[model samples]
Target: MIKNNNIDNIGGMEFATFRLKEGVTETRLVELSHQVEAEFLSQQEELILHFLVRGTDGVYADVAIASSQEKAEEYCQQWLRNKVALEYLELLDKESVNMTFWSKIN
Candidate 1:
């Protein structure tokens, strides 16, 4: 579904981004982060790199490097549904949430 043909190293890299809801506590985010790290990244064999980053203005980044584009997006959406639910994630635009990937490039 994610067309990565023109991107570099599409086979081994993926990226996701979002914005956190207002009034979301740091402690809550930490707890969710721990749960995600333990349950998904640690348990899922297909995911080699997975991280959630929060930037200024509540911007968030959900990055992953997996075996394929579908796997990468599937993993991200699964995590979001199980962890943050659908209501909290804010999309700036349809395109900004698009993921970018990279690999060893050998």
Candidate 2:
């Protein structure tokens, strides 16, 4: 199993924006989204980040995920390595453990 001591076990959301390649269609985007989701599900609960396909630019995708930052980055990189051409990628921000709404409001 994958293990990272620095990984934040606290569940939260991660937002990422990507630029697509040229001439990529909406139908293809949906298919790609599902593929990415399937890849993510393989990680089990440790990678329980919900992915949302925000939009597509040509052949790129603006995707977002809600999960641990470490896992998210790892997954995203793996995705790029295997899937679409990653023009650029970044970790927008990470919510601290106590910052999670589930924990904050409790």
Candidate 3:
């Protein structure tokens, strides 16, 4: 877990960066993200914010901020098993995945 006072209004954060599989377009990614949000994330009451961001290096990050560190960890575990989340993960390159959880101190 990350501990830094510079961060504020955050209890915990999940940061996952990866590259999409070959031939997967951003349009399909966004469409699947909506499904993940509705079917998985929305069910987590502790989830504060969630979004997908892209970098110039052709990598994308799936970010989720939660109300607590435990909730953040829980979400990460659940994400791996959730049907919609699994479907979403299918678009990403498995070997390129890097996921971590951080705890804020502020």
Candidate 4:
């Protein structure tokens, strides 16, 4: 599963956070990160993002990104060998979260 939240312009760059499944390996994650970074560089898009992979056993891996979602998903597909499914959750920005702290948090 993947959770995404859009953050308002930070230094004129967009930001998002993703929560992913834990089955992915460190090597694959790094490869994906590099691919995404390359895509952002090619497109001249400023991206600030991070991913947290939650394992069934509760362990997690964090991957930081500065790229586009298209590139990220492409890497995700490749990492899963085109066999696993991914889910995305909409996330509010930090200001939005603070504004509605009483609401069910993501």
Model 1 steric clash pairs: 13-101
Could you say which candidate leads in lDDT?
3
Which pairs clash inside model 2?
13-66, 14-65, 14-66, 19-60, 20-59, 20-60, 21-59, 21-60
TM-score, candidate number 2: 0.46
Model 1, range 1-106, lDDT digits (tens) per residue?
A: 2222344434565665655455666556566666656655676666666566778866667667776766766666675665433333432333446566555455
Candidate 1 positional error at 79, Å: 3.1
Predicted candidate 4 versus true structure: per-residue lDDT over 24-93, tens digit per residue: 4545545555554454323333334544444554343444342344444443334333211111211112
RMSD vs true structure, all candidates: 7.2, 9.5, 4.9, 11.8
In candidate 2 the C-alpha lDDT for residue 67 amounts to 51
TM-score of every model?
0.58, 0.46, 0.88, 0.29
Question: Where is model 3 poorest over a 10-residue stretch in terms of lDDT?
Answer: 1-10
Arrange candidates by lDDT, descending: 3, 1, 2, 4
The lDDT per prediction is 0.58, 0.42, 0.85, 0.35
Q: Top TM-score: which candidate number? A: 3
- Which residue runs does candidate 3 get wrong by more than 4 Å? 1-9
Q: Which digits, one per residue and each the tens of the lDDT, describe model 3 over residues 27-92?
A: 999999998888788888778888999997889999988877888899889978999899899999
- The count of residue-pair clashes in candidate 1 stands at 1
Task: Score residue 3 of candidate 1 by CA lDDT.
Answer: 23
